[model samples]
Target: MADIHITIHNKTFATATEPTIADFTLSLVSGEFVCLVGASGCGKTTLLNIIADLDYDYDGDIVVGQQHKSPKIGYIFQNPRLLPWRTVRENIELALPDDYAGDVVDNLLDIMQLTPHQHVYADRLSLGMGRRVSIIRAFAVNPELLLMDEPFVSLDPPTARQVRALLLQLWQQRPHTVLFVTHDLREAITLADKLIFLSANPMQIISEVLVAIPRNERNNELAVENFRQQLLNEHPDIKQLL
Candidate 1:
């Protein structure tokens, strides 16, 4: 588990007239599941990239873990991005660090119900199955910080629900500090310990809501809906931000 602190003073592109992120700061406690909710085309994905060290052109300071040292990060994108030539298990094993000890590939594949497909080529697996492989790959690294950007998007309802359950089950066992970005409010409500609402046009956090409902009770649709209703009723203006 790792604590993440991000502060973007001014992030802009050369061709852009204005900054994408300015004077924005957010903190994630170790082992906290925080979700970022915003409209399409917002800088949510960019923020994730910055945190994952995939983009460093931005003017920002990102510190992870207790000693301020670089922490191992696992990132799952919208697409699985797996190698077509690699088998499911191979894809997962490829993510392991050279110095890392122990083999988690088999256990992760078993837990994700991908054992039967472990020998299958990545090109042959369905979207949902490929996504499961990607999830396993991310977790195989035993990351202290995990960043997911709409990992379940474009999936069917049932498949998405199933994947979410599996993801949560693994997360509960490992407790990685996670920052998940989603456009679905209900998905955020279901997965997040804290909900961060963002606004576009220089994306920045506008509101944050704590999910007071217990993790065990979040699976109840009625309870989730009631909590959503209460949130809206309490912060009527937050609706505009969403």
Candidate 2:
């Protein structure tokens, strides 16, 4: 487990006039589940990209673990991003280190209920199933830091619910420092230990709310709704951001 400190001085596109991120600073505690929620196109994905080291054009400092040690990062994009020609197991194995045991993959497959479909090709899997493979792939690496970008988007209600439950199950089993990006307030409320709300433009955090609901009760619709209503009632300004 590793704590993270991120400080972005400024991030701007060459074609743009204003910076997308300016003087932003955030931190994640080790083994904590934090969600970043904001309106669409508010640079949420860009922030995740920066943290994942997929983009480095911005002027910023990202320190992972103690003494700025580099930690293994696992990123799950909105799309599964699995190779269409590869079997689910093969696609997951692609992320494993050479010395890693194959049983780790097998364990994750069974936990995510993908054991039956492990041999199926990615092209033949449904969106929800593909996302399951992606999640398994990410955790198979046993990453210290995990970045998720709306991994549950565009699924039907039932499928999305199932996936969410499975995700939480995996998370509980191995509590990695998670930075999840989502626009769905209800989902955020259900999953996050803390919610960080971002402003529309310039991509800065506007509010930080600690989820008061217990982990066991987070799945209860009534409990989640009560917590949401309480949050809105206390912080009315955050309603628009959600």
Candidate 3:
């Protein structure tokens, strides 16, 4: 299998000539975690939509690296998107592929420390817990490529930290390819091995920085703070929180 490559010539709004994302290209090796960042309304979600095949009007090439002719892709949006009537386990189970036969849902719940809540209705779950179910639902497909669009956006600091830990634990166990988008620089620094920055509206990638810290060291407050400092030192404009 070759590396996953996405080449976007342009994406538009009213007409083909009025472009949003123009000439953006990204490549991902198997099991790598990459994060995308940009100013709001810069078409980051639109780019993700194109990759997930939810939008097809743009001119681009999405080349998959896996041996399967069609790769399995799962997405977790800003909202949980769970069925209020369904149980936590049932919510995740619904995303499993038809041929799947293993205890995937049970295992994901176990690792996320959510097994006890398995039988509860989705509507009854706390915000953090509900988000965990959304994550489990995405991983239930055992996706070859996972796309996340600021899934941690609205959570409180403590809850967001816990959820991030759960996500890292799952990634460590399964090691699937990941493409995540976020507005928070610290969040990106905490999770991504590669960080991509996009320009304001004609959305184009302006810079890419590789995080050199070991994955295991990323969660330490001191280490993360130091790395965060380094990012600020290197890109003072990032301090503006664009």
Candidate 4:
């Protein structure tokens, strides 16, 4: 399986002398869905940016598949960053290799349930529809690693729940390694195979929780409620923040 190892001996911003993510080390195996939960200003987004190669000033060793091979890494942000001038299909196609565009775009549109609105421009779609399009666009290139930063934060609870289900279904189907960052504890528990808890400010991993429950059993009402309560009791700070 493909693997990613992130080792941060020390990382401090130029503006601030304090280290943001210190001694942060973790390995993510291919096809595993891991969630990182933390309070605000905990460097969650900063860490993601480093992983995505958007921030290079940090001091650390981030090794993916033994070497940096320009592997495709897809990122889905809180807002759907679709080009307003592009159609849903066009947006998804933009992520595909030029030679594979036509076939890949159609497949993604169907997979994302956007076939009916494939020709619709970004501005014409609803928020949920636009988010779906964004997801499809990210997955179209068959990324080795998928990084998400509170992708469902703006949605209502019910909508977020639906999106969570959709994400799980898609993960099962495509099986890409995922590193999701969120402030929502339930969201982290509901979707992650492994959970990494980060402490407030100058964030560092405080705990790693392995989820033993089968993915198929995650949504079972009784099991979910019981697990939720257990997590709440175990992590009082997290519960209090929520």
Candidate 5:
């Protein structure tokens, strides 16, 4: 895996006179899952858009690998963006390169546990199932980096937990660099190897914390709770309601 260095220097974006993010700087490594947690107007989504190359108007340098090439990026939004007219398999297949669609879709369907629901249409699937299809689609193209903005936000608690587990499993299997944005602290702690806490409007990186506990051991309830509390203590700003 290659290292991904992101440097945001004196970057600012505004709607009229209102600034979204300003003077932000952060670096993330490849194969690391990092989460950005902040308040509603803190520009978490805006920052993600910048990194995804969707918003380039900001004044700053956002670089990826050594070659400086635009790396392949996959984005999963709050809502599953599956095409309503397409079957589940077809939706996932849409992400694949045109020449290799057959093999890629078959493999991703099996990996995401969508084999049984392969022929089902998007409207007929449950929320959880729809989300799985969305994830499958994102991974089908084998992006070098994956950016997710609260991809599981709409699911029930139990379903969210299940999807979280599935996400970790798939991440371990492919090991792509991931930047997941969420207001849920526990979700951030559980899924991220590193966590960034951002301030309110005109967002800037306030703190960065590394979770040293091994991934396999992250599920221990007591340990997770202790770690969560430690994070809250270190960065009390995390307690603020988003």
Candidate 6:
């Protein structure tokens, strides 16, 4: 039923199923932007760690279909995590693999309008700028799968919105398979191609709701509100989580 299919089953020592994610199955089409939303303590970060193989105890099957070569992974954490002493461009350079394209960082910087700040030290930039640089670092390596763990959670609403728009622009330029985790319904609605809801404790996927509203159309506040209402109406269970 999906192009990018994954199955997970975990037997934890602590007998905790919520953050440990006992039983779960989810799938998505290639190049899809998937948002994983759940309650505050519902294993969202745990699940992402499993996906990145940072957690090894779990047993799961992951199929990414066929590709010419093994896919590289890019992970964006809650903080920008850029080295304080490194320049913005230097931070990106550090992430570049031997096979990285020459113009990759420059192209990313140009579109994010971060070229002017490329020479600035990581600590010198604003929070929003730091987040953008983190994003660029992820893309610089041309990763096949991008895992974002609430990269914009710390920013103010306005700053978060701006980063989201910039993220959209980057995604459109070269679509990468992205798994973004967030607790905010509005942010999830703004970014996701499909929504994955999870149960409270065990963190099993309760539903997969497609956001059919066109991305361009979702720019308007009223349109987003209307579409959200439609989502709530069709999938009333989401109301509780929201």
Measured by lDDT, the strongest candidate is: 2
Cα RMSD (angstroms) for every candidate in the order listed = 1.7, 1.2, 2.1, 1.8, 1.8, 2.6
Q: Name the better of 5 and 6 by lDDT.
A: 6
Regions of model 5 farther than 4 Å from truth = 10-14
What is the overall TM-score of model 5 with all chains considered together? 0.92
lDDT of each: 0.86, 0.89, 0.85, 0.81, 0.81, 0.82
RMSD of 2: 1.2
Against the correct fold, how does model 1 do in TM-score?
A: 0.94
Candidate 2 local distance difference test against the native: 0.89
TM-score winner among the candidates? 2
**How well is each residue in 12-108 modelled by candidate 2, as lDDT tens digits?**
9899999899889999999899999888888999998887777889998888765554457899999999999999999999988788898888889
In the range 95-207, model 5's lDDT, one tens digit per residue, is 77668658767776777777888999999999998888888778777888889999998899999988888888888877888989999878888899998888865678888
lDDT comparing candidate 1 with the true structure: 0.86
Clashing pairs in 6: 18-201
Score candidate 3 by TM-score against the native.
0.93
Which residues of candidate 6, in runs, are more than 4 Å off?
11-19, 66-71
Summing lDDT over every window of 10 consecutive residues in candidate 6, give the lowest-scoring window.
Answer: 63-72
How many clashing pairs per prediction, in order?
0, 0, 0, 0, 0, 1
Residue-level lDDT of model 6, residues 112-176, one tens digit each, is 98999999999999999999999998877776688999999989989998999999999999788
Worst 10 residues of 5 by lDDT: 7-16
Give me the runs in candidate 4 sitting further than 4 Å from their true place: 68-71, 237-242
lDDT of 1 by residue, 163-198 (tens): 999999988876788899998888999999999988
Candidate 3: minimum summed lDDT over ten consecutive residues — where? 63-72
Taking all chains together, each candidate's TM-score versus the true structure is: 0.94, 0.96, 0.93, 0.93, 0.92, 0.92
